[model samples]
Target: MNLNLYIMLKSSTIALLILLSGLFISCKQSKGLTVSNMKKHHIESNIKGLGDDTILVYYVPLSKMGEDYEPIQDTIFSKNDRFAYDTPSNEPILLYLFSKKGEFTRKSGHPYRPDEKHIVALVKPTDQLNITGELKQYYLDYQVQGSAFNEQYTQVRKNYIEATSEAVSIELKLDALMAINGDTTEINDLFQKRNAVNSAGRNAHLEYIKNNPDKDLAAYYLTRQPWEIFGKYYNELSLNVRNGIFKNALESKIIKYKKYTQVQEAELKIKEGESAPDFELRSLSGNFSLNAVKTKYIVLDFWGSWCPPCTKGFPKMKAYYSKYKESIEFIGIDCNETEEKWRKAVLNYDLPWPQVINKLDIDDDVSVKYGIKAYPTKFIIDKDKKILAKFIGKDDSFYQKLDELMATK
Candidate 1:
């Protein structure tokens, strides 16, 4: 009676591929044409089976798209909460799938619209796809049910004077204890502890499910929990963790967190006009010099073997380098890359730039030194070895700046 097997079977990668591929092809059919110049498009999932048990997500990045696509009405979606959508218009129908991950789409349905100059994703649960739609049913038996139960639980806990408040209070207390502590020696130490606590909590939760194999909590915990946790706190938590380095330390161990911080420190050092600190890194090819790439204008690019965005940008860089070889020199600084993957990426990417790897076994020193808070941070330097400008992200604005600066020189 282990429902986990069914859940696993339903949530297989193959199923997602099929569903996504279907969506991709559907978007490409030129015959079913709908043309529009409207400010925003209304989107909803035509989910059929689960009458009232579906979660929907919609995303809009204001910075990218501007203020054109604001919802005309309020857009909350969960069904069973004190603060549940009051007016019918308040229900969020635009479920944004783009915020979480990338999906294949026809070139015509590219996420960015040409004239709009914005990126937005509208997503919602659909009965058409059995997995994302019935997520609620999988959590019905757990003490912590789906978003609905969570919403109800929150209200129940908040209304201490009301009935069932005591039970809700207990659950909240248990969650607080099991969750990672936020205070610790260093941010690094805190993250480690938090991860350990999270691991322990998952194990305990799994054991509970094993004993209650018929229950859906197992599926909820394994499949839907990541979405719930991540969806609820993705943006805020990301910003906080990023800004948190200065605020306070985490109570758990986070290896990734430490790596990011180290990279940040190095970036700051280089930004403050410190000498481009020298570090030797081992690559698949051989040891190479980080400082050796110094030229009239060095373009130090941070990338990894696994990143898709890196692959897309490398070609453009190669083309740019070829056009301006005498005026500029480019250096590829590999980050968190395995030797095999590094070599393959270089060959596949057809990167014409001088490439080097960090052999110091350092945690991505190039990224750290250049204040490369993210991938594809490019810095323009004058012949005097001073930084001209730092491009934050790999976008058109970045290239525009490069062209402008190169022209000025």
Candidate 2:
């Protein structure tokens, strides 16, 4: 089974949707919702075989909420197999229940483990939820009482677990067998079986959305699906659901999907060895003319203060800058950040390089000229203004590629 299918079904679109404001911390006087000034909703869970571990709680971010799209994250230690959590949600939304042992990815903000012990509940602001079940048999025999949407999604979730269980089992078996060079014929047969099972599961989940468009829970199901799947049955959902809690998030997804389509269509807009796009970027000191820089090479770092991976990669970036400061011109292009933050970041990081700031959103018109789709993008250009390489993420690959170029000298 493809790992992405699980991501789609469970809807990890969360980590991706969080291209928004920084996360807000709602400090609690205690786990029992003691904050009088802040909006707090509570959830309690009592389970067998979970007393030894903690529960990680995460609520889905609402893109429609404007500045409040960052979800509240918390880790609660269970006392005697029972624990409670305080979440913030003014409307009905999805909340994830992850066992600490599940190793949920914080950066991605979702569970990558397909068979991880977890629960997905539809939480409403006014309702108090109680989850009672054996952790091991959660999908088969769990009870989420006191919320209609929670009850509705739990029903859908059970069958989904059943549909994908066999595939997950086979996937684990394949993992073990592949580790020791097990039977080739057996591996091939298992691969086919898993794919078949996953395809059926995917179809069934989609069919439920198609057949029962009136249920708001079905809209929740649609939320878990990727845009390719959601676009198919969006009109089928009830008008209330179409314009309800999911409205803002759904609209955001649609706009992003359209932009992604545009980026895909304009694949040739930026590439290595091509003439660098004609553009002007200003710095605090003076006009930072691109053509005027006559260094052996130019390393253009397109970054933003809001991006974690971008700023986190600066240590290694500075090391490279220090090594090649005399031979190469290093420039940092700050995008989608306020000028104040950009200037502060330059001073805070103590970066000895030219810095240019773009105080606009990622979708601002300026980004289109360079064909940038994501943050922390970089371009290495030769003295002749031809792009040598382009990198998207802040990773060792960019530095490794730089090393290959410098080795010739």
Candidate 3:
């Protein structure tokens, strides 16, 4: 009778043990699901010496221009010299950080002078990046940690900077010389020396790309460097890196480079002594044709409303138009902008020249026809519709060329 009772108790104990085991397994699975569902990707930073300055974070793409040119910015105020950004993606991206005060200074100053108080960081989701440095050495003398790619980027950037420091110094001297109209021989010598340093830096970048084919930093440099120089490296990169966040951008660059090569081959058709490609576009005055404008000379200025350089160059264009209106025709072709923006820019700048709009999104037919790659590209055509000179950006040389051409009968 005692043995039977003991067996019954043992069976009951085994049943209870099995029930507890099932409950334990269920609870573990539930906890795992909860953890998996939680938000995981974030960018946290502790930037020292920034005080309470307003930090603006921007997602700057590789192309740096286009309809996507509008940066995705977050206005975060620094409290206790710290800020953070959270996103759902863990993919690496180019992030630019700037103080609101510095941004204002950048906008107000010469457009070409880069903001010295800004820093460019390679950040990704779930990265806890820490930047430590004084405000005076915002970009330089800073320490970054927490992401492998960012650390690699920082090292590469430091190497590049060190390699190009001599060239930068030479460039600064050259700028000063040019500002004061120094001797041509000295200026030319400085320019050549600077170019040689730049070449060395470029070679260093190539070697870096070769050594780190799998790194996203390589892909970034592939996009930033000239196609003729870095295109081969891009092909050598692993498929995984190539097809990452910058895949579409890299592909677009390849396409544009191919188009640019084609344009170079066909540039003879629009070079000096060759006839200009004729086209018609809608203007504020109404539909206008290039052939219809009869004058001793014509200035075809291809620009866009969103382009900062174009806006800066308009005042000079206006002055030139005022001086040469009697002897030459000035026409502005606005590209890749909405009608509203185009009109507003034209009116805001008081552009007296006949203005036309290119409705195409990218690589407008008119720009492609003339092999125009960048703005504000200007073409000087004679009465016989022959291309005399082509200018990429407005400068003293552009006006000098115009003067020389206008002087000709």
Among all candidates shown, the one with the greatest TM-score: 3
Q: How close is each model in CA RMSD to the real structure?
A: 19.0, 7.4, 20.6
Which stretches of model 1 miss by more than 4 angstroms? 1-254, 272-274, 283-285, 293-295
For candidate 1, which ten residues in a row score worst on lDDT? 1-10
Residue-wise lDDT of candidate 3 within 263-285, one digit each (tens)?
56666567888898888889997
Q: Using TM-score as the measure, what is the rank order of every candidate, best first? A: 3, 2, 1
User: Model 2 clash pairs?
Assistant: none
Best by lDDT: 2
**On a 0 to 100 scale, what is the lDDT of residue 134 in model 2?**
69
Estimate every model's Cα lDDT from 0 to 1.
0.40, 0.65, 0.63
Q: Which pairs of residues clash in candidate 3, taking residues 3 or more apart in a chain or in different chains? A: 42-126
TM-score of candidate 1 to 2 decimals: 0.41
Report lDDT (Cα) of residue 17, candidate 3: 26
User: Compared with the true structure, what per-residue lDDT tens digits does model 1 show for residues 77-113?
Assistant: 3222111211123222322221112221223443221
TM-score of candidate 2 versus the correct structure, residues matched by position:
0.64
Error of 3 at 337 (Å): 3.9
- Residues 112-213 of candidate 2 have per-residue lDDT tens digits of 344325676766667778887766522224668887777766665566666666765676677777667789889989999988876755666687788877
